[model samples]
Target: MASIETVTLEVADPTAADRFHTAAFGLGGQVRLRASEAPTTGFRGFTLSLVVSQPADVDSLVGTAVDAGATTLKPATRSLWGYGGVVQAPDGTIWQVASSSKKDTGPATRRIDEIVLLLGVEDVKASRQFYVDRGLAVAKGFGGKYVEFATGSGPVKLALYKRRALAKVAGVSPDGTGSHRIVIGGGAGPFTDPDGFAWEAASPALTN
Candidate 1:
């Protein structure tokens, strides 16, 4: 089965982005950085999510990110879905730190359970079919609203959400232009999706 191996974020300063990510999330090799002068504005059509164990973990991660130069879009708060907060990285990428549990079972730690790449697409169903044709199996679906792909042991899980809705969730405007400034390194191939997100063949070094 095809799975995402690594996510490459194109930033103006690779060194700075590397420092920020390492200090903020300690993501290791699953997320990579590349130098680029890509012209991008507004939302950039997606958000990266860090899923943690509990509310305290959410706060911990969010706090660390803010200290690492990330700007908070939404303060961590309880909601129907649990606790979450949104932040924008200095390199112009949006990240959501979230948890499904309202209460903490233990002391907070910076352990992240999952990293999800949520693409904001115009049509969830069409993007879903497009990925399905590319060998990604749907793990869950919510009509035409959302779809998540099975990642197995891959470092990052992939999911789709309507553009406007996703922007609202991330507390950003849906309007964006220029390159997505992100690339998916996976088993899929060197193809661009309907939403213009690029994908490349996975590199063995990315897992090393």
Candidate 2:
């Protein structure tokens, strides 16, 4: 199964960035600090989504994020699809914490089960085809409005969205600043997508 080994973020303050995320989200994602490589602004064009199995987790994560210096984009609420909310992490990356149903995975053994990287692009069809050509199969989608691809059994799920619409979903503006501030490694990578999202070549450690 294909899996995203880890995500790499270029930030001016990698330590602080890592600290904030680790505290707010409790999932392990890596950060790289390169003064010369850091972008002037913050992340845009994408959102990191965490899927839990309980409605209460949606609320808990949102509260945790706010306590960790994240700004609440949307208060936790229930919808027919489930319950969830959005927040902008201290480093300016938006995070979505959600559960698709009301079943509790249980507090004693609960953990985030998935991290979906949703890219906001100008055209979803083009982006979908781009990945299809790179060997990713469509797992699910809604025409060109939104689409998710099979990224193997990796912990990360890759999906595409309409630029402004995705931002609206995250409760942010579509005007992304600086670089996209992300790197999705391990698939047809070392290449940039149509929107300039970076994907690096898989390293030896990731080959297994």
Candidate 3:
């Protein structure tokens, strides 16, 4: 099955982004901060999710992010779905620290187990088809409201959502300007998704 390799954010300041990702989250250079010319920006059509092993990890991550210049949009709280919260990075990137597992599944060393890149698309059906056509399998999904794909053995999770719902989950306005798209590329040949997101074949240097 096709899966997203990595997410590259085109930001104005790569240095701050690098610092934020390192301090706020334990990401080690997987986030490529390319330069961008678009000035007026908003939600950027997506929000990143950090799936942790424990509920306490959610609080720890949220606190760490706040101390690292991230704004707490929502405090860590418990819900039936599990524990989770939202925060905005120094560069305005929305992140949700969450754990679906109710208890420790087993002894694990890693804190974050997965990174789900949730995309806001115009047509959910068309977007789902775009990835399905490109060899991604549907893990689970609603009719047109949302869709989550199966990214077996891949670190990143790819999901589709209505633009407004995506914005609501991140606690931000859906409208935005500039290049507000994520390049879930590097694993497949170069092509543009239905919503204008770009993808390029995986580079040998970036492969982990």
Top-lDDT candidate index:
1
lDDT, each prediction: 0.93, 0.77, 0.80
Q: lDDT tens string, model 1, 54-115?
A: 99998988988999999999999999999999999999999999999999999998899999
Which candidate ranks first by TM-score, i.e. highest? Answer: 1
For candidate 2, the TM-score is: 0.88
After TM-score superposition, the amount by which residue 83's alpha carbon in candidate 1 deviates from its true location, in angstroms, is: 0.5
lDDT ranking, best first: 1, 3, 2
Candidate 1: regions farther than 4 A off? 205-208
What is the C-alpha lDDT profile of model 2 across 69-182, one tens digit per residue? 999888878878988899987777788988897566667233787888889998999999988888788899998799998888666788899989998888876775668777
The better-scoring model by lDDT among 1 and 3 is 1
Ranking of models by TM-score: 1, 3, 2
lDDT of 3 by residue, 136-173 (tens): 88999999999999988767788899989989878888
Clashes of 2: 3
TM-score of each model, paired residue for residue: 0.97, 0.88, 0.89
lDDT of 2: 0.77
